[model samples]
Structures are given as structure tokens and as C-alpha cells.
Target: MRTLVIGDIHGGYKALLQVLERANVTKEDTLIFLGDYVDGWSQSAETIQYLIELSEKQQCIFIKGNHDVWCHEWLLNPEIENHIWFRNGGKETITSYLTNNFDTIAHLEFYKTLKNYYVDKKNRLFIHAGFSSMKGPANEVYLTNYRWDRTLWEMAIVMDKRVKKHSSLYPNRLKLYSEIYIGHTPTLHYDTDVPMQGINVWNIDTGAAFTGKLTILDIDTKEFWQSDPLPNLYPDEKGRN
Candidate 1:
């Protein structure tokens, strides 16, 4: 029973499938997805439906992302316009529903069921983004931070490497978990298409929404697998590039 942490899918259902096959994933494996599952590619709605189906027979944990929050709100009240979301890949997501068979209510429920974050038996943290409190996510004052915060990752990047984990200078947040796995900030921004480790935090989002590929990393082995770039999988689509 392996635990696999997946990165931001960003509606690339094709990329999702390829990585699963490439990783040789099995039903016994636990899939902890870090969200941004919808938006970017041309199959946003299809991706959700597929996952909803996949979860029926596979062990899956879904984390809510910023994009997912926007998508859910729009589904609940389509008349309310979120121009920011629309400008950033939301338009493509809506078009995807039109192109596919969308069960509006079921999809909305699926979104509503997503967790803000998850802590495993090993005390490892799997979150879409980051939390603010030194006390950790459960005690976070602003839940939106769980989906939008970048400071956690920023802190990890800027931390002085010389500061040991046992040192007082070590971040409290880093000290809270045995290992932190996240996906809101793509590793591509840091100039790598593979997973990057900052302190003890591992960023698995390989920019599947844009030029990079989708990735799945085994939590135990630290080994990983990737699909072709989103553009290659959806050659006719721009995929938020």
C-alpha cells in the first residue's frame, strides 16, 4: 500500500492518465491529489467526472485549491461573475462543461467535499497551498490561506541552510511536520520541471497547467513519475500557456 502524492492537474485529464500509467499505480495505492484539478485544459469537466468515478474504486484524497473554490462558487451561482478567475483559465473551464456532459449538481457536491488539507498517519502534511499559523492548518485563522498562501513556500526557500532543524532559527511550520507535500506553487517557476525540495517541504506541482508536465511522487521512496508536457498531450490547446 504505497502513498502517492499528485501535483496540480489543472484539467489535463490526459496528463493525469499518462502519469498514473507511467507510475504503474495500483488500486491499493493511495492517491493524495493537491488540487487545481479543474481549469486550463479543454477537459475540465471531463477530468472531474473521471476522478469522481475513479475514486469509487481507488483510494483517493482530494484537497481543495484556489481555482477549485472559484469553480465551486460559480457552479452554485453562475450569474455571479468572477472576472479574475475568468481571466485566468476559468473561461476554458466553463467551455469544457459545454463540450461535455456535465452533471452540475454532482460536480458541485464533489467540489464541496474536497478537504482543505490532510495529515497522514506519519504526521506528514498534504495541502494544496499553505497555512499561516505556527500552530498549523487546523488552527489557521484564515482558511483561504490554505488555498492561496505562498509565504510558507517562500519561507522555505529563504531559510538559511546553515540553520539546523534542531536550531531555534528553524521555522515552526517546518518543525510541525515530518515532511510537507504541497502543489499550489509550480516547480516550473523555480526553473525546474520536476519536484523541488525546499528545506523539508516538497513542491510537486510541475506546471501541468502550462509548459510543464504532470507528476506523481511516491511519499516513501521519494521516487516520481511524469507525463509529457500538457501541450504535448493536448497539442491543439494552449493550456494556459
Candidate 2:
């Protein structure tokens, strides 16, 4: 059974469908979504619903992204008011729900069930964002900080650089995992014909919410597949839904 690790969908349902169709994913294949399943497009509700259906038919792992966290926060406490969420394509998500008259309850339930990370015995780690290496109980710190702490992302990048440089021989560093798949940072030249290799940290977020393609990486083979023709939902800078 092949495992396909997908990146931040960000409500690009059309792009997502195209990628899945191109990949010809089967029910036996395990799909690990790297999160940001909602917000930043016209079809947030539809995208979440599709994921829920996909999970029922296959081994699916969903991790929480910062945008997903914002969605949860908006659901639980809409009164709290998050300007950043509104500015960052969340306005469209809100409008979609409102247009459907809060029809996203089931989709919201799907997001609520997601975990922050998944690890396999084969040394494959999947997370929505970066992890923390705070020398405490390893899993505890990694999970808590990776999902909820932005500060940890900054620190993890620094630590990741150091780890990449010096941890080739150290089993302690290597023992953590052989490879990690993540999203959140969007590659500007995502659809360019550039070949990427070397580090096993595969970042598949093609930034579909921002005129980019959707991406999927086959974890075992490290073969990347992406949707053709980048989407352009947000054409203006006014942040209008």
C-alpha cells in the first residue's frame, strides 16, 4: 500500500480533485493530509466534506494547521474576533458558511478530529508545521509546540538547519525519524520545472489559496505529483470575499 502525503489544501477543491485524479489514488493507499483544509477559497465547505468522505474509504491522517486552528477558534469563539483570519482568505470561508447558513457543522467536526502529528515505525513523520526539540519528553513537546506554538516553528527551523548539518551520524538525531513531511510555508515558484531533492523534508504546500498548484508526494518513493495550472481565486489585494 502506498502512502501519499498531501500538503495544505486551503479549500482548493478543484485543484485537489485534479491532483487526486492525476495520482489515481486507490482505497488501499494511505493519505496523510498536512492540513489547512479550510479557509482561503470559495469552497471551504466542499473541501472539508470531501476530506470527510475520503477518510471513510481510506487510511487517512489529518493534522491540524494554523488556519485550521483559527477555524476552530472562530467556531468556538467567533466573538473573540481575529483580524488576521479575516485578512488571510478566511473571509471567503466565513462567507461560504454564511451563504450555506452554517452548513459546515459536519466539516467542522472533521477538522476537530485531526491530530497534530503522525509517526510510523518506518521513520516517516508527518506534521502540519515544524516541531520542537526541547529535550523534554520528546513526543509531548513535539506535539504541543508543533501544533499550537508559532514560536516553536521559528526555533524548529534553526534547530532543523543545525540538525541537517551535524546530525548525520548521531543516532539520537537520526532516531527521531529518517524523513519528515510538512506544510504551511508556501513555495513561491511551486509549479516551476525545478527539481528538488537531498533533504527528506518534503514541503508540498503549493499555495493554492494564493495562485498556486496543489501538490502530493508519495512518501515511500518520494515522487511528487501536482495539479496543473495554478488557481487564482484571490486576484485583488483588498481581501474581499
Candidate 3:
């Protein structure tokens, strides 16, 4: 069985489908989603529906993202106008649900069931966002940081490349994992639209919510598949702008 890890989807349902088809996933495969499944694009409801259906048929691991958390809060209290969420594509998601009469209750439950992170037998860590105070997988000062922090990735990016010295200095930074996979912070921000790897940490959010493509990487083989650039798929979309 293969382990496929997908990056932030951000409501790009068409892109998500393309990546899945390109990856050729099967029932035996382990599907790991890095989250941000809602918000952005025009089909958040449809995206969640497909994900719910996919989970029923396969071994699926859903990691909660910051956007997902915002969505969860909004779902639980729709009367509270969350300006931040609404400005950042939440409006589109709500519209989709209202238009389709989607099952908000089931979707909310699905969100509640998502994990903040997952560690495989191999000690590979999968998280929506890396934590600033992540001493180890089991030690985090603020649990929500696991889905909202970008300091870990930033630290990894600026850390010295000397493997030995870097490891010695920040021994606990990512020492608990053989490798770390994260989303939330798009790789495109660093000028690359593909996964960025540094010191055993991999940033796989290729900014599919913006102009970048959706990416899926095989945890073992490291082989990856990407959907076409999102702007091409939805020409008039502003996505996460």
C-alpha cells in the first residue's frame, strides 16, 4: 500500500480531482490530506462532499488547517459574522452551501473529526502547519499552533544547512520525526510553486488557493503529481486574494 500526501486544497475541487486521478489512488492506498479543504474557489461544498465520500472508501487522514478551524467556528455559530473568514473565501463557501442545500451538519461533524497532526510508524510527521514550540509530536504548548504556526517552517528555511551543526543546535526542532510534512504556508511564497524541502522538513502547500497548482506527494517514493496551475482552471477566480 502506498501513502499519498496531499497539500492544501482550498476549495479547488476540480484541481483536487485532477491530482487524485493523476496520482491513481486505490482503496489500499493511505490518503493523507494536509487540509485547507474549504475556502477559496467556488465549490467548497462540493469539495467537502467528495472528501467525505472518499474517506468512506479509503484510509483517509485529514489534518485540520487554520482555514478549516475558521470554517468550523463559523459553522457552529453562523450568526457571528467572521470578517476574516468571509473576506478570505468563506463567503464563497457559504454561498455554495446555500445554493446546493448541502449537509452542513455532516460537514461540521467531519471537521470535528479531523486531526491536528499525524505521525506514521516511520516517525514521519504530517501536519497542517508546523508549530513554533513543537518540542516533539506529543509536546506542544498550544495545540492550535499545530494548525496555525509558520515559525517552524520559517526556522527550517533560515537554519544553517550544515546538517550536523544545525541538528546539534536545534536538536528538538524536528528530532522526533524521520521527516516532516506540512501545509498552510504555501511554497510559492518562497518563489517556488513546488514542495520545498530543508533539513528533513517539507513544505507541500503549493498555493493552490492562489495561482499555484495542487500537489500530491508519495511519502515513500517522494514522487509527486500536480494539477494544472489553478488560475488556468478558473480564469476569473480571485481565489485567496
Candidate 4:
């Protein structure tokens, strides 16, 4: 069974479908979505519905992104004003549900069930974002940092490869996992639109929320697939601009 790790979707349902189709995911495969499933594009509601259906048919693991958490709060109380969310693609998500008149209970349930992080038997860590504390993935670290921190990735980007010396200075950060997978910081930030590898961390967020594509990688083989550039797919709309 193939283990596929997908990056942030950000309401690009067409991109999401294309990436899934390109990967040829099967029932036996395990799909790990790194969150931000909603917001950005005009199809956030459709994206959530598709994921809910997909989960019933496969082994799907969902990680809660900051956007997902904000969306959850809004779903529970639509009247709440969150300028940050609304400005950063939340308006589109709201329009989708309002236009479609969807019963969002199922979607809410899915969001509520999402995990902050996941660690497989191989000791590979999957999280929406990284942690702030130098401490590795543990219960003691602040949970919110798991979905908001960027320093962890930044540190890994310039880490020393000498295991012994590095482990001595950053024991908590170094000794925990065999590899890490994260998706909150888009690869576009580095002026690239593909998955990036830094030391032992793999960043799969190719910026589907903006002009980049959605990416999916096989955890074991490191093989990957990407959707077409999102701007091309949604030619008429401005995505999170």
C-alpha cells in the first residue's frame, strides 16, 4: 500500500481532484492531508464535501491547520467576525456554503476530528506546521505552536549534518523523528513551486492558496505528483490576492 502525503489544498477542489487522479490513489493507500483544506478558491465547500466522501472510502488522516481551526470556529458561530480569516480567503469559503445551501454538520465533524500532528510507525512526523519549542514532538509543547510556528523549519533549513555535535546542542529537536513532513509554509516562499527538502524535513505545501500547485508525495519512495498551476485552473478569480 502506498502512503501519500498531500499538502495544503486551500479550496482548490479542481487542483485537489487533479492531484488525486494523477497519483492514482487506491483504497489500500493511506492519504495524509496536511490541512488548509478550505479557503482561497471558490470551492471550499465542495472541497470539504469531497474530502468527507474520500475519507469513507480510504484510510485518510487529516491534520488541522490554522485555517481549519478558524473555519471551525466560524462554522460553529457564523456571526463571529474574523477579519484575518475573511481577508485571507475565508470570504470565498463562506460564499460557497451560502450559495450551495449545504448542511455543514458533516463538514464540521470532519474538521473537529482532525489531528494536530501524526507520527507513523516509521517515526516520520506529519504536522500542519512546526513547533516553537526546541523540544521535539511531545505533549509538553504548546499545541497552538504546532500549527503556527515557522522557526522549526527555518532551523532545519540551515542545520549542521554532523549528527553527534548537532544532537548534543539541540537534543530535543534532533533525537525525535526519522523525518518530518509539514505543509503550512508554502514552497513559494523560497521562490519555488515544488516540494522542498531541508535536512530531514520535507515541505509539501506548494502554495495552492496562491498561484502554485498542489503536491502529493509518496512517503516511502519520495515520488511525487502535482496539479496544474492553480491560476490556470481558476482563470477568472483572484485567489487570496
Candidate 5:
């Protein structure tokens, strides 16, 4: 079975569908999503609803992103707004729920069930963001780092190429996994619109929240597919701006 890992969606349901279609994903495949499912464009609620239903039909692993945590908190207490979250795409997500007919109960449950991270039998690590511990994510001291950390990816990107994995200079955190996949920090930050591969860490968040396209990477083959730029898909909205 193919193992496909999807990147940060940021409420671009149209982009999600386009990437899945472009990738020709099958029910037999294992789909791993790197979260941030809501809080961006006009279809945040629809995206969550679709994912809830999709999980029932196929094998899917959903990692909780920082944005997803904020969205979940707001869902639990819709009345009292989290000002920080609201300023950063939460308003758009709330607006989607108000205008859409999604099942809030199921979506909330889905949020509750999201894994902070997932490790495949092949020893690949799938996380929304990064983990700081050398012992891996399971022993992470600050669980919030699973959704908010960027240091892991940062270290991977800047490591000296000459430092062999066996060398003491190599990072022990990265040494624990065969490969690591993450999506909190957008690749667009580095001016790329595609997945950024750093040693064994792959950053698949192609800035779908802003101007880049939604991306899906085939973990085994390293082949990937992307939707049209998110801005093009939702011309009328300013996603996560």
C-alpha cells in the first residue's frame, strides 16, 4: 500500500481535493495529514467534516497542528473568543461554521482524537511540527512543542553536510528516526513553493495558508503532487493573512 503524507491545508478544501485527485490517492493507501485543517479560507468547516467522514472509509492519521489546537479551544467554548487565535485565521474559520452546514459535534470529536504525532512501522516520524527531545516525541518534555516547535527542522536544514550520522556532532534527535515529516513552518518562508528536504527531515507545508499550493508526498517514493496555488483557488478571500 502506498503511504501518502499531506501537508498543512489551512481551510483550502478545494486545494485539498485537487491535490488528492492529482495524486490519485486510493482507499487502500495510508493517508497521513500534518494538520492545520482549519483557520484560513471559507471552507474550514467543510474540510473538517470531509476528513471526519474520510477517516471512516480509509486509514488516516491526523496530527494536531498549532492552529488546530486553537481551533479546538474555540470550538469547546465558541462564546468566549481567543483574541490571539481570532486575529490569525480563527475569524475565518468561525465564519465558515456560521455559514456552512457541517456537523460541529463530529468535528469537535475529530479534533479531540487527533494524534500529536504518528510513527509508522517503517520508523518514519510524522508530526505537525517538531519535537525537541533526543528521546523522540513520545518522551517530549513539552508536549506543546509537538505542535509549535521549529528548532528540529531548523537544525536539520543547517547541519554540516560533512557531519556523518555516526559522528558525535550529528543531532541525536534526528538520529532516532529513519525519516521525519513535519508541516507547521511553511516552505514559503524560505521562498520555496514545494516540499523542502533537509537531510532526513521533510517539510511538506508548502504555504497553503498563504500563496503556495497544498501538497501531498508519497513517503516511499518521495514523489509529490500539489494543487493550484491557494490564492488562486480562493480569489475572494485572504487566507491567514
Candidate 6:
């Protein structure tokens, strides 16, 4: 029973599928998606549908990302204007929905149903972004505050940075239950730095939407697998023209 922790998909369904095939994931394997499942790429709708089906077939845990929350808000109440989604690859997601003529209500409900954070039986934590407050170690953070509170988000960022610096100096400052798995911040490497724990909090977002590799981490062995690089779906102004 291998537990696979996947980073942000960001609508790169092709890359995701390739990674899954490479991993040879099965029903016995639990998949924890760290959020940002949609947006950025052109296949947002397709990605969501794939995830929906995957969730039904396997042991899957879907966490809400900042982009997911934005999409939910816009889909449920578009009249109530918000820029968070639009600024962060929301336009691509909206375009995908409109192009596919998807049922808005159904999609919105799916997004609403997603959990903001997840804690495993081993007490390992997973979130889209960083946590608000972690009590003992990376795994014992308050899920509610980590997911929904704005103040906690601000403090978490600060603490995370501090921990990252300290961890480098004192390699074994603390060891919580297991470790926290997160996405949202794309990194060139599979395991980036976090305060206090050095590489305690693993970041798997390999920036697939930016034509980068898609990453998946094997929970038991802590091994990482990646898909072949793809073209950036949403290139910068220089590449757009």
C-alpha cells in the first residue's frame, strides 16, 4: 500500500497521466493531491473530470488550493467580483469551462466539497499552501486555522521562513509525527527548503503549467518521479506574441 503524494497538477492532465502511468499507481495506493488541480493550462476542465473519476476509483484525498478556492467563489457567485482567481491562472480555467459548456453548478459543488487540509492516520499533514500554526512539529498544525484563517497564513509564512534558516544550522531541531506535504509554490527541485526542518516540508510542485516537469513523491521511500517536460501552456508576454 504505497501512498503517493502528488504536487499541483495545474491542468496539465497529459503530464499527470504520464506520471501516473510511470508510477503504476493502484487502488491500494492512496493518492494525496496537494491542490492547484485546475487552472494555468488549457485542460482545466479535463483535469477536474479526471480527478473526479480518480477520486471515485481509488483512495484519494483532494485538498483545496488558493486557486481552487478562487474558482469556487467565482463559479458559485461570479457577480461578486474577485481578482484572486483571475490573477492566478483563473482566466484559463474559466475559458476551459465555457469552452466545454460544463454545468456550472455541478463544478462549483465539486470545488466546494474539497477539503482545505488533510491529516493522515500517521498524523502527516497535507495542504495546498503553507499552514497557519504548527504546534509540536510540521504535522500537528491546526487544520482549520491552517486552511481558512488569513492571520494564520501570514504567521505561517514567517515561521516557515524562520524554520528554514534555523533547520540548516541545527539539522535536528525537531521532528513532528511525520511531515507536511504542500504545493502552491513551484520549485525547480523536488524537495525545497523550509525553516526549522531543512527539507521537512516537501514541495512537489514542479511547475508543469510552465512547461516544466510534473512531480510525484513516494510516501514510504520518499522517492520522487517526474514526467517529461512539456511546453508552457501560459507563457509570459514575450512568448505569447
Candidate 3 residues lying further than 4 Å off, grouped into runs, are 165-167
Preferred candidate (lDDT higher): 2 or 6: 2
Our tally of clashes for model 3 stands at 0
What do the candidate models score in CA lDDT, each in turn?
A: 0.93, 0.69, 0.88, 0.90, 0.93, 0.67
Clashes of each: 0, 0, 0, 0, 0, 5
All candidates: CA RMSD (Å): 0.9, 4.1, 1.5, 1.6, 0.8, 5.6
lDDT comparing candidate 3 with the true structure? 0.88
| lDDT comparison, 4 vs 6, better candidate | 4
RMSD of 1: 0.9
Worst 10 residues of 4 by lDDT: 165-174
Give a tens-digit lDDT track for model 1, residues 95-161.
9887887788889989999999999999999999998899999999999999999999999988888
Which residue runs does candidate 6 get wrong by more than 4 Å?
A: 134-175, 189-197, 232-241
Off by over 4 Å in 4: 162-171
Please give the ranking of all candidate structures by TM-score, highest first, separated by commas.
5, 1, 3, 4, 2, 6
Candidate 4, position 130, lDDT: 88
State the lDDT of candidate 6 residue by residue for 49-147, as single tens digits: 888878889888888877777777777776766666666677777778778866666677679789877778887877776644334324435654443
lDDT string for model 5 (1-241, tens) is 8999999999999999999999998899999999899888889999998898889999999999999999888889888768988988999999888898777788889999999999989899999999998899999999999999999999999988889889999899989999999999999999999999888999999999999999999999999999999999999988987
The residue-by-residue lDDT of candidate 2 on 1-241, one tens digit each, is: 8989887877777778988988989999999998888787677767877888888899999988888888877776767778898888788877766666544577668767888788877867777766656332245544555655443333333444435445564323334667766677665444533123324455666666566668888887778788754444334322222
lDDT of 6: 0.67
Worst 10 residues of 1 by lDDT: 96-105
lDDT of 3 by residue, 101-211 (tens): 768889999999999899989989999998765467467888888888888888788877775634558657767688999999988889999999977889999999999
Q: List TM-score per model, in order.
A: 0.98, 0.80, 0.95, 0.95, 0.98, 0.76
Candidate 1 clash pair list: none
